[model samples]
Target: MASLKERITRLQSSALFRGMTRESLEPLAKILNEESHKAGTVLMDMNAPGDKVYIIEKGRVRVSRVTSYGEETTLQELTAGDIVGELAPLDGHMRSAKVTVTEDAVMFAVSGEEFEQLLKSNHDVSYNLLRELGDRLRRANDNIISRLEEQRVNIEGRMLRLHKLTEASKSINSTLDLDKLLTRILEAATSSLDADRGTVYLVDDIKKELWSKVLQGSNMAEIRLPIGKGIAGVVAETGETINIPDVYQDKRFNRDFDKKTGYRTRSMLCMPMKNKDGKIIGVFQLLNRTDGAFTKDDEEFIDALSAHASVAVENARVAQEMVQNERLSAIGRMASTIIHDIKNPMSTLRVYAQVMKRKSGNEEAGKLADEMIHQVDRFVNMTQEILDFTKGVSSLNIVDLEFGEIMNSVLDFIQQDLEKHNVKLLRETQFKGMVKMDQDKMVRVFYNIASNARDAMPNGGSLTVRTNEAKGYVNIEFVDSGTGMPDEVKKRIFEPFMTYGKKHGTGLGMAIVKKVVDDHKGRIEIDSEMGKGTTIRILLPAA
Candidate 1:
């Protein structure tokens, strides 16, 4: 057995008894009892009332919590010279975590009441305890802040990647040219992903091979590989996105291309481009990320990029087909016009020739000759009109002419056509002033509008033409009580070859009117509703 003085020395050496003087420790030495726990012994149960404080003097002990799933999670391991159960005595509460003996252990145990009395009697002991508790609280707060900062960084990275993907979609969708569209797609992929090099391989279904159109860093001849030969080909065949940290280690990676080009390949990411119908169309591959190996995030980003590129490729192909169709249509319309215009003249010529042959001996033969001459004149005039229209309005005989008189002449020229369609015309002019213009071109503008109105009101409708002179400008408006245009047609009304609801229409009338207006430095405005009426307003600078 140890002597009283020896026991007192051991007590003062403990962490809990630190800073206590010999006089203060004398009472604790007598009250503290030496206790031993066998290995695998439970010293205290969590949530149980604890009235004693234990200071470990030998061996190791584990502190742990039992989870809701009934599994033990070790909170900490404490060895000799450490203190446990001290917090419970200070707050007079139950144990927070269960304490178990991992090995045979010895501890100094003191009742809660005795420890409280000792703290009150010694100011140094109380001060030391407060300092230790403060340190533990600070460490816990630092751990919490570290976890929150990590979460915030992850969120910011996701948002930045999403923004880049959205911008890439917009850039590729803006163009219909195949060359420019493919170039932009490759540029966007390499830059956004921080790739050192990239290439886009489109699958040629007819040839049953993969062909590259755009490859970064070198202008090589088109690369063609069989459908199952290389890594990119595999991705195209399988419709899978692959990320390889070490391209050399993969057996499927082809090294012959690298040797031929004198380029070293490192990391690789290959993704399949699929159309909206979910059919694989191409493969996009990137090599050697600038920072490190490509991760799961890079795979997700590239997958989204490939989706947009697929749609853009399809759109460009469709637009090209439409352009080809328009060219063929223009050729057909030109041939038809030439044949239609010359047919009536040819018919009149045949009729007069037959009459002249049969009436050769008649008294009225001279009168018939005069009629044939008149018909020849009409044929020449028809050919000249067609030639003028095809030549466009190049020579503008610009001169000062009364605005009201020009309007009257345009109305009279289209009067017979208006009567044939049963359309009424109303004219209102507030200006009789002379305006600088090419009379022939201005008359053509009025003729086109009147013809359009007449066609719109097949049964019958009123047409109104109004002119007004304002400060330094003149305004002419054509309003018609005819079937109006839909929003889609109205938006593209001035584009050449855009027409609706007319069988014999060439769709060039408004386009020509716009050209004339622009040459004179003027503006045109249109207002219409589907079921309501249509209005066209033109503004010209005053002479």
Candidate 2:
């Protein structure tokens, strides 16, 4: 489009070719071919051999190269009066980067060999080219320094997160209480992630549910959901991380809890917490990030925190279990000593009471003697219950006796205790069949159940002791009209130390009852409801 003089004028204005004489630029312009390219055209490709050098006469071109991650990164941009492919020709190697036309452009292309010769023959042009290359090198150096500074800041931030995590893990790991440990983990995780609130759900494998004790102000509320129900549940089931910036937009978000608690959840990040074995044990759900949506860095930090939390959780659970086992062992040792020392004296007291009843024919004194013997037997039964539970003592003095005789004895034992508590005992003995049982232990079983019923009926209620034989078993039911158990307590009723609303004894009454029944190859079933009453049915093999 321009004349020869105009083309030479343009060449002289270029920074790399500036200060060149007309004679020096004449031959360079004469050999030049003007090429027009559309946007997005590749003028030079990375790693391609140097064939030509182009002087941009119009529009823009971008110099970019692929990074190690296979991402294309723009190095620099060249506009009109700038040149591309000059470095390849100067260095006598392949192009270092891909150059693409960002805007429709016209360029003056000269063969690489000719461009190299022009640089050598023109002294002033060569000096200007060196100056241009030196400016580019300085820019590259600045870019490197800027990147290094950014990386340094990132590394420092990561180090700080790691330090916080270490302290948090230490605090959580030292506690044997699973509840307190989970609470600390949630607190530390929320602080580390800069979230307003958080919850840690533990997987209940048997129930196929995810449950957590979420702290609300000074109280902790138990929350449970099926493995695939909610955000945390999904993370628990899938073992994947979920980051939702706008929770309201997600259909899975339930606003009911937020509405009830008067809390608004804007963003959420949930991730699976896995044990050391890489098995997902739970999920950490963080809500309403204080800053904004959770970033990649937050995700990475939480991923690490989950690892520490999982290990701590596992340790706390194991420690709690060991503590229970050790406590039971200690009780077993104490019971063994008591049985050795007390059994002989208790037998002598029972024999003396029998003699008193035979010698003193007074009706009231005889009744008093009978009570003394019963009281001695009760003390021995109490000690034996502990010994049986802790020592796994299953030896039973099996005898075939009328089931009614056992029920009548249990009724007489509990009637006195029940009368003192204003609880009425109604007896309905229908099963006359013989049962293979240990009479003393079976009496303890019936007495324990009746005692628990009496305690439940603190405000004067009726207990019906009924028996019936069916399906090769004799069913003895202690139906009480008293304050019953909640599902939570009922589920763990047989576990040692589990108790509800009782203040008098070690919470091992039901546990011993279960152990005694289990030894007789019998099973016990319980039906209870809050505010209603409880029915404990013990079924023994009918002889």
Candidate 3:
């Protein structure tokens, strides 16, 4: 046992006595009773009385609470020079958490009444205790902030991963080329999971093997493995995700490939890609992860991404086949139509040339020459329309032109055709402001509409062309008093390969008009009845 003087020295060294004067600590130290507790001893129980405060002199103590399941969860650990039971003494409440001696410990215990009296009598002792309590509160606040920061970081990481996966899916789905699609999928998978390299192996069901379609890190030729041969093969065969932290330790991992490629294998993540029918299409194999081994979260993310990849692969395969078949069909139809249409004009031109050669300087020779010129013009127009339809609207020569001027130019170009068809023309204008548009394309739009109107009226009818400005848009309307169209014909009028009643019609006129309007960010509305007439309205943004 130590002397009272030694006990006084120990008390003065404690955190609660940090700022106390020598005179203030001497009397408190003499009244404190020295206590000893062996390891595993319970110092206090929860909801117990608040009678004394204990300051640890040596050894460790654990503060814990019993959960509803009867399991003890440690809140904190205290060592020498720390104090417990101080909160109970200050508030006169039962112990909030139980304290136990984790190691054989000696402590100085002081009664609550005697401790309060000492604090009241000594101003230095009171200030020291208050300061110690404030320090504990700051430490508690710091712990809470640390925990919140960790949670925030975890949530942000999860959000970023989800965003990357979504973007990868979109990119993979956009391409129809199998090789390009596979490359993009592998790149996205390895990068999202922080893997060094990756490979996409598609299963060859007919051959009972798996073949690599895309390998990220190596320039080696395509590698083929039998089903159930390697890690990837096993996943493809069983349709399970395998995350191996050490590739060498796993019996499923094949070492021959590593030896041939001169690349040391460390870790691997292999998963099977399944289509909507639940049939495995391919296997995604990721090499060693950059940060560490792949986790459960990585497995879940890869599984979701693989589902999208499987659908994309199947779609690309089907789309490629469809495109090839369409190309062949289009080529056959275009060749046959061109040969049949041009043969008549060619025959007519050849006959007119022979007649001109024989009847030189005759009155009928001039008339025959004019007719020949007309036939050539018709043939050129037919060919030009076909070329325009195939080229598509890729670039536009945009300019600001007055709406009234554009309408006048279009009407003048088609006035002769209207007269030839005996169709009366009616023009109406409300505004003459300039509109930002592609001039040539806009002219083609009006030309196609006017030509369609001429074909509709074989006998004679009225053709109304009007322009107005309203709601910040320039509206152009072409209403014709000719044989109109039915509801079904009007509905599909703007679709390619749809024509109601016309000979030598490629069925691309209205489709081209709609494409031009859409490219200019404009709208087109058509209203037609079987006998009443047709009204085609175009709205373009006013400049």
Worst 10 residues of 3 by lDDT: 213-222
Q: Give the number of colliding residue pairs in candidate 2.
A: 0
Pitting candidate 1 against candidate 2, the one with the higher TM-score is: 2
User: Against the unseen true structure, what C-alpha lDDT does each candidate score?
Assistant: 0.79, 0.87, 0.82
**Window of ten residues with lowest summed lDDT in model 1:** 381-390
Q: On lDDT, who's better, 1 or 3?
A: 3
Model 1: per-residue lDDT, tens digit, 386-477?
34444442456677788887777667657767887889888887777878787767667777888887878878998888899877778998
- lDDT comparing candidate 1 with the true structure: 0.79
Q: Rank the candidates by lDDT, best first.
A: 2, 3, 1
Q: Candidate 3 on 1-543: residue-level lDDT in tens? A: 768779878877888787566766777777888999999999989999979989999999998889899988776788888888877877888889999999999999989888777777877767877887787778768866886897799899889988999999989998999878888999999999999998998887888888765443563245678888778888988998899999999886779878998998798999999999999989999999988799998998888998889989999979977774475357446745775688787767767776785678776876667557654655554454455456442566678888887778668768877998899888887769999898767777888899898888888898999999979999999999889996657866986667877977767779878988988999999999888889999999898
Please give the range of 10 consecutive residues that has the lowest summed lDDT in model 2. Answer: 214-223
Ranking the candidates on TM-score from highest down gives 2, 3, 1
Please report the candidate that would top TM-score against the real structure: 2
